[model samples]
Target chain A: MEKEICISELKRLSHLYDIEITVAKKAGRRWSYIVNAGEEKFLPSQIVDQFEGYALFVEGKDFDNEAVVNAFRKIIKKINAQKGG
Target chain B: MITESSWIKKVIKEEEYKKYMNGEKDFINDDEIMQKIEKNKNPDPSKIRNIMKKSLEIQTLSPDETASLLNVTNPLLWEEIYETAAKIKKKVYDNRVVTFAPLYCSNYCVNNCLYCGFRRDNKEEVRRRLTLEEVKRETGVLAGKIGHKRLIVVYGEHPLSDAKYIANTIQAIYSVKAKTKNGYGSIRRVNINAAPMSIEDLSMLKEIGIGTYQVFQETYHHETYKKVHPSGTLKSNYQWRLYSMHRAFEAGVDDVAIGALFGLYDWKFEVMGLLYHAIELEKRFGVGPHTVSFPRLTPAKNAPYVQKTKYKVSDENFKKLIAVIRLSIPYTGLIVTAREPARVRNEVLPMCTQTDASTRIGVGAYSLWGKEKEQKLNRQQFLIGDDRELDTVVRELSEMGYITSFCTAGYRCGRTGKNIMELLKSGKEGSFCKLNAILTFREWLDDFASEETKRAGEKIIKREMEEVKKSATRAYSPQVVEELENYYKRIKNGERDLYF
Candidate 1:
């Protein structure tokens, strides 16, 4: 089935700046490579950090400690970075 | 023997403006034009000779003749020309429309093609190449969004996104499950479209079950190609793009989608060249283009050279061009992309067109989500004309009398290369066609089509069977006749749809 980012609030907040990764295979139940972070760039990949994941960006710093809503801010920051901001 | 003079090119450029009239080429002034247009009538068959002659004689036309042909207002001629074309179509396709869609593996490109929004020079451009794991991820997402059983995996061939990478991705998409049809389908096959690659690259693609390889010439003329394409391997070798399909065929990829970016050429010459290419393929490999697409130029960033690529066919003429394709190849899958508006898209949905639900929905709808309140995209090549939902286009087509089919004839029947050629060229009707007609009628009636369309199809099929009987001399046993009669009668009587 077509998988969607489970986080609705994260989607709404980061929808503009963030990338909609094509969710690749999920490893270990949750960690999946959505899309290769730097695979698409014209420049070099090693210079900038990249995330290939089954996880959605959360507003919180730590998945263990913070609330889910805060992850939107965190996700948005990642998304903006992907945009080369 | 053919004229290769640059002056001939001038004739083409002049005629494009419709200033000079070639008496032999002008259909409007032809006496049959008025008779054919006489108020409310089925086309006169006597006009067929002239029309056929016209279609053949003006095989390649100057722009003026092309414009005149497109300007055909005679509804009778339109019906007759299209019907003949449909005959050609039926011969090859036999009531089947092959369906497939692009699974963009990566948006990354090395070229600064002047017309493409994906050009690296365009700073606003957002590019992404799905990694192997990411490729699999996109495949999963696409599998869910998948509408048709055949997949056409597309990617830009940057050095990073090489042949091996694409080959692996092809395998990846094929192996992934789409809501679990369990290999019965949900995307059974793949067709590849990317830059022209070596025979080795094509072999890898074929090994991965890549069915057709599509590479658009964009424009057949070389200098214009250089001008528009600007900086890339594409600009360096126009011949590579032209003969890519040919080379692909050599590398064991027989099914190929050959098309030109329509707005970029002298439309008539371009079309005739397409037919010529199909004819050439038939001569070479015993089959024509597996599919033909005519994607018009939609607005894109840094695409200022779009006008220089100018062979603008208006919406009306676009329909006329489509009709010509239906008449010309008649059998190949004629594809119309999301580059058109909703109204035009809906209006032209039936006349020789192929599309998938995914293309019209979820993500492929990227090009179509014009100025809406909220939209998401990596970035799009151009705007989309049709903004209708899948259900909406389905409804409208049914209402307007069309078979909204998702039938994948390629998967079930042994229909890809020579098998198809043999079936069509044998000049003998068989059980395959009979069963296809029955199944198609029933499927459309039950699901994708409207009540009125279903009725119209039944009526047309009944009339067509009588014609078929006359056309086919083979006689059948009494029991088989009874069975066939019962099948038709039961269907006509509004029986439940059944697959044979």
Candidate 2:
């Protein structure tokens, strides 16, 4: 089976990174995929649920200056955003 | 006349050269070998031949030379040694160490290793060999832990936990091709580290896509080996153990790892024997050890040697041996295990992993977690030298300017077997570079690497392209470089997916 970093992991990444942003992505995406909160080309798929192929990031200086934690926030916010949508 | 001729014991002169050439030999530390080599400014082959009647090159390196090679502080020498490793890495791998885990399918054994808790005679311990389903479950669990790209099924030698059971387990490991099967599609390889097998059993594993066949001699000295291994599979024929690599080679398993458990014999003699073994294998077959391991004896549940000081390896000395081994056999991969503490393992391991770009990994190391003691982790076989987490190791490698890689050119290409060695010996460096280039890119594109790791990999790629450019300067194709650039962009943007 394709074991992904589960969608629930975004919350964990969010909590760990200490940031607030909304995140959503295509479902079934490998959750270990770290989204650099800095890049523009990396974006969420238009199809909300099938978004396993894409992700959203909370743009901020945090993403660039400290990407490790920033990636966590982006991933969590993206996951949470998708759930809300 | 007999008594007069019997003056021969004195005439024998106890020559150091005699032992190495043909019989049971009197080996020396590096100090002695170098002393002899430097004694005469003018190395008169004829004169030395008149005194010793031996070829100058008829020898493996002495213990001190082995040690000196390990003490190799120069990056220039490291590059010289690692160049061959890099070339071989380019051929068999790229910048990758194919990760796997040891599924402790059975703890049963019939041998008394004197140093192992799982040895057969340890009646005080609860002995358990997992059933087929249990084995499957463990494999199922392990498949998820390391992301299932490969697995190394480990078991102690016992009658019940025999070849048939092992073969079945291999199938079960492979059968769980889906993550929902509580298995993973990630586990593409399974290497076995069990007892010496029959031709038939070895054949089964060969058919099973087992990546490599590995066995440690523990100690190459027969007397010491028997003394330590009083009552197990190891107690049998020492020759069988020595010749096992030959057997695996014959069975069509190209990748094999051989190691000596240090502190068992005079470390110097053991190193000489190891060199002999490696040289013999390469001379016998075009390919030698896919990897070599140096597992210093450490504490275990039933281990009795913790207090034994006679043969223990000093950290500085062991590191020396490791360095020399890297320099001596440039093409072969060297492995350092968690048997030592994190400090030692951390210091020595990078030499094999990054600077050397070694193909070695922890024997049953499930992840970078083996570097540290984590509650969720398995009870490792021995005390680990470094207990850093996997991500930490990746970060450290990157921080240290080494690439944390996931390249696996071996899987994508058919370089396994006589085919690979032939290409290597013939100096088909381009084919090798091509293979590693493909794998390094694939890894960067998929694995959850950090930015620093990502950057190191990028630098390595650029440096390697420049290397390829330098060698084939005018003749180099622009297409390969262009393709690499696109992959780099995709990786940077996180546009590619695993196996995409």
Candidate 3:
């Protein structure tokens, strides 16, 4: 299921994580968003193809990896609910 | 039609100009730019290496650093700078050259710039604006027959082709779904190269998904700008033109391109001016220009200034300036257009990221191509130096080991504005560039390329696939490789518009 996250929520989460969440066309069966999480804060990161549960897109030794992944999972759940509805 | 004077007055909004200014000043501090050039005249070899290193790190060079690069006189040092420029481009964009076609929509103007064939005073020239239907026709030839996925749609400044007309024309071009060899062809991106527009108009364009809003300051030298553009014209207001990108950003148009006409002033000064422009954009918006163009002076009908200009950039100086630009703003896409001859383009292509091919500059030249074999100078803004067909250019680029890409995926996927800047700086964008180049090249080769071009293109694709496979663990994750291989197979089976 895919949920449409509002732009404001997207911007808020982007600022909170210091990352960019680019809303892309719904490609193929999935992969609607291009979330970037680079080495340093605010650097656009690698392209993640799927947003499955707890899909960690972050890298480097700095951040709390589990915390970020958990947060992303919840966010994806909400978006998916919205999309499915 | 509105009278010329009122139209000019309406277009130059004082608020848009003043909003980006500091007190009474604009960003281009003329004296400071000149002084930087003067002080950095004899740049140390060590200092030059430091600047080049910063560029390799993908940092925007300080004005002083760019000025020092401009002053490097040693041929050996220049060679090193050229090589570094190529390295930086490869690091950021990979070995892909993105191609687009220039579609001039109109030639009517309110400003009588001395260097332009479309200037108001040139009565001998034929003026025409493409109606929406005509725009679609031209787009058909470009997207359907020529297989272009992008365009830099140009327009002269006049009420006839004002913001409303620009918006309608873009929509018309986008509406075209012309038949091709394999599938339907349509322009995925339409970048505008028109005069500076108001915030509201820019918003309208942004809302319509206009690709890049480009405005060349012509020359950043203040006095030269005023002289060439003439007093009492919309374009003469240098502050208005200078603050165009600021207004564009304010209006939510994040993808903006900036440029200067190099022959209007000293090449070194012009290079500094471009650097300053990039710096200002980066400072204010946290994102620099998506592309920088430096079109040197070319002959225009009845425009004697082209020949009379003392500051004309020679071919050697042109290459130097381009390399300097590449090194200075390593993250930005450097464009070297078809305005340059084939030899000059071939020489400079190593450092450039994007260029136009299969270009026709006349008001309605594309639709009128086969009917009129020879170029009619009166209908064109300027004569193009290269008129090679898209097939030849694509084949030649393949031979040079550089894949010709028709990827409009980045813009569509929102890899623009600050996101693009961050990606470019980190050298992460090249991964996307490599994958998209392969996919789009395959699409183009199958759909429209001649047998010769197809052969050349297929060989390059094989090499590129091998590289991707070799770099699987290094450059791309195994999962990403799996997806890429799937997409490649799908495209091979005639599915289209698939990208990473």
**TM-score of each candidate's B chain against the true B chain:** 0.70, 0.71, 0.98
Stretches of model 2 off by over 4 angstroms after superposition = A1-85, B1-100, B131-148, B178-185, B231-234, B353-380, B423-476, B483-500
A23-60: candidate 1 lDDT, tens digit per residue: 22222111222222111111101111123322332211
Model 1 agreement with the true structure over B23-111: per-residue lDDT tens digits: 43321222332232232144344544355444442232232333344445677776666565555544433443333455666766766
List the candidate 1 regions with Cα displacement exceeding 4 Å.
A1-85, B1-79, B86-99, B180-185, B307-310, B360-378, B409-413, B425-500
RMSD of each: 20.9, 19.1, 5.9
Q: Higher DockQ: candidate 1 or 3?
A: 3
- TM-scores of the models, in the given order? 0.62, 0.62, 0.89
Residue B92 displacement in candidate 3 (angstroms): 0.5
Give the lDDT of residue B384 in candidate 3: 91
lDDT of 2 by residue, B135-168 (tens): 6555544444333345556777766666777877
The local distance difference test score of each candidate is 0.51, 0.50, 0.83
Two-way lDDT contest, 2 vs 3, winner: 3
For every prediction, compared with the true complex, DockQ reads: 0.01, 0.01, 0.11
Each prediction's fraction of true contacts recovered: 0.00, 0.00, 0.06
TM-score ranking of the models? 3, 2, 1
For candidate 2 chain B, which ten residues in a row score worst on lDDT? B49-58
Q: How many residue pairs clash in each candidate?
A: 20, 34, 3
lDDT of 3 by residue, B1-500 (tens): 57867777677789777967789988888999989999999889999999999999999999999999999999999999999999999999998999999999999988788898998999998989898999999999999999999999999999999889998999999999999988799999889999988899987787677888899998888888888888887888898888899999888788899999989989898888888999888988798999999998999998878989999888999999999999999999999999999999999999999998888898888997566646679989898999998999999999999999998876655576776788899888888888899999999999999999999999999998888878843357565667778888999899999875
